[model samples]
Target: MKPLVVIPARGGSKGVPRKNIKELGGKPLIYYTIEAAREVFDDDVICVSTDDKEIKEVVEQTGLEVPFLRPEKFATDTAGTRGVLLHALKFYKEEMDYKADTIILLQPTSPFRTAQHINEALEKYHFGLDRVVSVKETDANPYFVLFEENEEGFLKKSKEGSFKRRQDCPKVWELNGAIYIINVNSLKNEEVSEFRRVKKYVMDEVSSIDIDSELDWKIACSIYYNIIISRNIDSK
Candidate 1:
């Protein structure tokens, strides 16, 4: 099956100005995703979808193509990721005559994901899994979560279950936004598969950092510094 790697980046970043192109560790943050994609797929299968020219250039330098720039409406801060991805898929199908069996998303925000992670997710995705995403076990269990009244100042349990300990509540996973492999036709209208068909590809916390905020950027840098940068390996 043919696999396509897609990277979505918006020019207007409220958290960190030009966040996608911002220097993290040493290279532009987009470089990480670009390199990781290149490692797993050929140049023809990797593409960058961004509204920013700088991002396009950076992606091009890494040998990835910016054949299309995402529209401004879908690049806004409030825009959901599903919109950008669906638009990109439509653009490729109609304009470029490309139809991939699987479309994998490698968000530029999560810079620490490696080529191995991509391969692992793909293995699961091709094994009849509709959707596979990189996830890490959430530290806070939903079983112990509380819900406060929006205005009336009332408090209650968020779910029906109340476990004696967080570990006893079973496992809950959070979409790290690092990687997602989905069937191309499955995203016809931007709605990912229902939770029932969605599968999780477990990743370590160190590799699951999604840098959308200033605070998140700092934390990512620290984690990378300790886990990757300091290890003397050429970071992607």
Candidate 2:
């Protein structure tokens, strides 16, 4: 399949300022994702879609081209990911005369998402499927722990179930924001959330970590040093 890898990294980050270029484990946070993507795809097909100059500079250090700074309209906090993807696709189609059949979205926040995870997810994708998105089994099961407030201001289970124990509840999958192998035609027709033929590529909790806050950053660092780095050392 002809695939275009899009790595969207915006400049403005409220939770952790300039998080895309922020150093994590002695490398820029986006570096891990770029490095992983490079292992699976060629530099030509991989695009770092960013609106920040510094982000572009940091990414270019690895020799991967940051083709274009995303348009301001698509870089805002309210900007949707669909627009960003479409915009990147448009650039490749119009400017480079390259049209990709599949779009692989790898967010920079998930540093632990290895090249193997990407390849595994790609293996699960085909032309007929709308998307193959990476997911982790959610801890907050709607049938067991998740709740909602009723009109009477009373708490109620989000989903009706008679399960007495958390383990008895049906497994719920959560989008890990690590990998998304999307059908280009399907994405052009509708938003990702509206896709009906979506499939899940299951990942473990550590591989699913998406850092969006200070607490998350701390957790990611702890995992990186204690688990990821230790494993790399052990493999030597």
Candidate 3:
């Protein structure tokens, strides 16, 4: 399958200021994703779509050229990822004459997601499917814990179920925001949220950690120093 890997790294981050390029474990946060993508795909097919020049430079440090600076309109906090993906696709198709059948979206926030995870997800994808997105089994099960307020301002279970224990509740998957292998034709026709033929690629909690807060950053750093680093050393 012809695939184009898109790594979306925007400059403005409210959760953690300058988060895309912020240093983590002695390397820029985006570096981990770029490195992982490089292992699975060629530099030509990988696109780092960023509006910030600093982000472009950081990506280029690894020798993968940033194709183009995203337009100001698509770089705002109000901008959606659908627009960014379309813009990148348009650039490649119109300017470079490269058309990709599949779009592999790798957000820079998930540092623990490695090349192996990407490959496994790709294996689960086919042109027939709308998307193969990575997910972790959610802790907040609607049948057990999740609730909603009714007209009387009373709490009610989000989903109607007679399950007495949390373990007995049906497993619910939470999108981990790590990997998204999308069908180009399906994406062109509708937004990702509208896709009905989506599939899940299950990932463990540790690998599914997506850093969007100060506490998340600390946890990521702790995992890097304590677990990931140790694993590398042990393998050697």
- Candidate 1 local lDDT, 108-214, one digit each (tens): 89888989998898878763566888899988666776454545677765665858877688788888999898876667634673534678899998888899899
Choose 1 or 2, whichever is better by lDDT. 2
Candidate 1: stretches off by over 4 Å: 148-152, 193-195, 233-236
TM-score of every prediction relative to native: 0.89, 0.99, 0.99
Runs in model 3 lying further than 4 Å from the true structure? none
Task: Extract clashing residue pairs from model 1.
Answer: none
**What C-alpha lDDT values do all the predictions have?**
0.81, 0.95, 0.96
Candidate 3 residue-wise lDDT, 1-236, digit = tens: 98999999999999999999999999999999999999999999999999999999988998999989999999999999999999999999998899999999999999999999999999999999999999999999999999999999999999999998999998999999999999999999998889999999999999999999999999999999999999999999
lDDT of 1 at 211: 92
Candidate 3 clashes between residue pairs 3 or more apart in a chain or in different chains: none
In model 2, which range of ten residues has the least summed lDDT? 190-199
In angstroms, the error of model 2 at 166 is 0.5
Which candidate do you rate higher for TM-score, 1 or 3?
3
Error of 1 at 161 (Å): 2.4
Residues 13-43, candidate 2, lDDT per residue (tens digit)? 9999998989999999999999999999999
